[model samples]
Target: MTLFRAFFTLSRAAQRQLAFGAILACLAALANFGLLFLSGWLLAGAACAGLAGLAAQQAFNMVLPATGVRFFAMMRILARYGERLVTHDGALRIIGQLRVACYGRIAPQAPAILHAQRGGDLLARFVTDTDTAGQYYTDVLIPFIRACVCGIFFIAITAIFSFHCAITLAVALLLCIVIAGAIKARCATLSDRLSATQSRIQSELADTITAIGESLSLGASFHQQSVIMQCQAELSATKRHLAALENGASSLIAFCATLTALCILFFAVKDFQAHLLTLPEVPMLVLGGLAAFDVMSPLPTAQKTLAQVHRAFDRLEDACFSNTTAKSTSNDKAFSDYSSLQFENICFRYSGQEQDIFHHATLCVKQGERVAITGPSGCGKSSLISMLFGFYPLQSGRILLGGSDVHTRTPEDLAQVISVAGQDFHLFNGTVRDNLLFANPASTEEDMVAALHTVQLTDFLATAPNGLDSFVGDEGLQLSGGQAKRLSIAQALLRKTPWIILDEPTEGLDATTEQHLLEQLIAARPDATLLCMTHRAAVLPFMTRVLRIQDDAFCPSEEKKP
Candidate 1:
């Protein structure tokens, strides 16, 4: 879709407010013109009458002209205030909606499709790009509309005095608009480059902050800082260039407005010399024409902003809605019964890697069976689990759950069927209660307390200042590594799905703690099937069958580890 069409679609919900804001802007512009035009006419007519003597002065009604000047002045002030209030409010609403819409479009395709994208780049699109798009409405749309609306009115009024003056003003306004468009086109590439530079800076800063401890310890801090500084310098340079262009455009626009005013004055004076105008008409025409040109002065800056808006929309579109693969046709409904998982001659490889992680590998886990897959570190064990849960696509072959392709089910349906507790589980920067409720919203406080007790987090919560209400800092930084892993297991247990997949669930815990955690998990949901991937022998005793991954294929272990 075109950038303008996409922007309009996103802003549709606030159409009424935006339209009303535009009307208010036009009213304000016209009121300002009236204030200046009437004041000039009133002053000139009063001076002319006074010079004609006492009878002319008495005949000239100063009361009506004076009242009109006051009226226009009040209208200008009130309309200006109303215009700013309405337009800004509407623009903020659009920005909020744009962020939400972008998130909604990109969320379902996350990690699976967005695995190649940097977190900082995506953050820039969500925050910075959305804000830039919102500026289009306030800085470009409303100003352009106001200028056009007031321009026609100004010409019509001028024509009432001298058609030649009106023609001069109209042609000058059109020339200014054309020049503004040309300047905007010229700045398009710079605008695009500026946006990319800002994203790069955001990305570099985000990466540095995330790994500050590692960088400092490894003595790579200087290198990382240098890289970020370089990005910042590039960003600053691009912004400087853009500023120069905008300033130049503004100066040219101002000069054009001045020239247009002079032309209109010259036409008015010529008409006066020809007896086609009076002294009062001459100043009224000149002042009114200048006021109208003043309304068009913002057009150049507004046009420059349009270039930035275009680039913003382009980045937003690429991040949120581009290159998305459609889900395969299959049953959208969640499985109603406990079903077996089957991998049929599957072939898989990671992106940008030549080696196959799995080559025609096949495996099955029968319903209600406790199965464990064992492998060394970096053996694609986690990748296998991710594939089974539909996180990655297979190069060849199929993964079926309950006799249906896993790809056929929506994330919602798949979520209902399987729950995973992995080493990389994320925790929100919220109260413990909030994170717990995320797994199963229907779980009660008592249920949460019981689950926490099962995972041996009861002691930690007891020591917390507010029990379940205590804040678990960003990504659960408040908790130890072992505590976070236990919390992840507790969340998985809370899900109560038909299938549970655990990745390195017992890697960091002590033997006693692991044993207790496993016992409680088995007792809590005895009917649920467990599929665990672990490197430790401690988890083998709980499994009915232990399969070892070797040569990219699963083989039944000769004997279960004691």
Candidate 2:
């Protein structure tokens, strides 16, 4: 979708709040102009009256106009505060909604679509870039709206004193706007480049931090530091260039506003000489012109901000919605309770690869059956699991679950029916309960304990200071490899799905521990279908049927249990 359309859709939720905020901003601008104009007019009149002696001083009433000055001053302050509060709140609300929507879009296109992207780059785009996009509403859009509305109002007020002055002010404001637009156009390419550089810097920093230990061991920490410093220097140089352009724009805009005020003063003096304008009206008109420029002063900054916002939206759009293979499937479709899985005539290959991982591969697993799939390293075992989860699109194949196409099921539906515990599983840096609840939010303490017991983590849970609430350090770094893997298994088991897929489930465990885990894992999910991909023979006897990949297709293995 176009950026405009995307922005519109994402901002619809906060439109009411933003619209109200815009109105308040306009009010604030008008009040500020009123304060300046009334103060100038009132002070000029008072000075003139005092110079004209007692009679004129008596004729000039300062009480009402002074009161008007105080009123406008107060109004300006309150309105400005209200405007900021409402607009920022609305902007924050829109940003929060956008983040959620962005995550929802990107979540489905896992390893395949996101493999090339660095974690930090993706994070910067999702969080930082998306937040920058929100500034378009508050910084660019609102300011532009206030400038236009208040600009017209100021010009109308000026026309009451001198038509020439009003026309001059209008032309100057229009010129400033035109110049700001030019700046925006010029900054577009620069902003895009800056955004890319920033993302790269984040990626580099993240990689360095994540591998700090390895870098230190290899005596390469200084190299990574140098690289980061180089990126930082490039970023600083780009920002400096952008700032120069912004500062130049602001200087030119201020010059135009000052020149416009002088021209208005010249017109006002001529009208005063012609008796068309009074002395008090001269200062009022000149100061009013300056106040009007205040409304437009933010235009240059807004225009410059627009360039960055555009880049942010473009990055968010690409990261969130691009290259997704999700299909429009009916969520209402009924999924059978005792469904069989069928992979028929499957053909698959990764992008930029010469060989097919699977070619005309067919496999069938009946309900409640234990199926084992074995293949050499670098074969398609893990890829097959990814396919089952719709993480990658098949070149030519259909995976059926319960007589329905696997592709036809929603992500939520698929998650409800199948759970996979793979090697190299990630555990979030949160409490153990938090991780388990993430898999199944409805799971209770009893359910979690049972799953933990099945994975042979009962002893650790008992010894953990906070039991289920015990924190798992980053990626479960606090736990041993076996404990981490078992915890992940417990998390998967908490899903209580009809089918569970295990990929090298016991790869790092000893034979005795692996055997015990396999036994308990099967016993815990007695009626659930099990699909395991393994190189180890210890798990083979538990499988009702065994299949091996030969020439890119599954064949009945000779080791299958009779």
Best candidate (score: TM-score) = 2
Give one digit per residue, the lDDT tens place, for model 1 in 111-176: 677888888999999999899999999999888998899999999988988999999989988887
Q: What are the per-residue Cα lDDT tens digits for candidate 2 across 1-562?
A: 4645767787787788889999999999999999989988998999999999999999999999999999999998998899999999988988888888788878877877898789999999988988998898999999899989999999898887799999999999898888788787778977987998899999998999899999999999999999889989988988888888888888898999889889989999999999999999899988888899887778878887889998898888888767656473648755765479999999998888888999988999998899999989888888888888777888898998877888877667787788888875899999999999988999999999999989888889999999999999999988899899888888889988888988888888898889889899988889989999998888899999899987999988887464
Error of 1 at 140 (Å): 1.7
Error of 2 at 464 (Å): 2.1
lDDT of each: 0.85, 0.87
Cα deviation at 342, candidate 2, in Å, is: 1.0
Angstrom error of the Cα, residue 235, model 1: value is 1.9
| Model 1, position 540: C-alpha lDDT score | 89
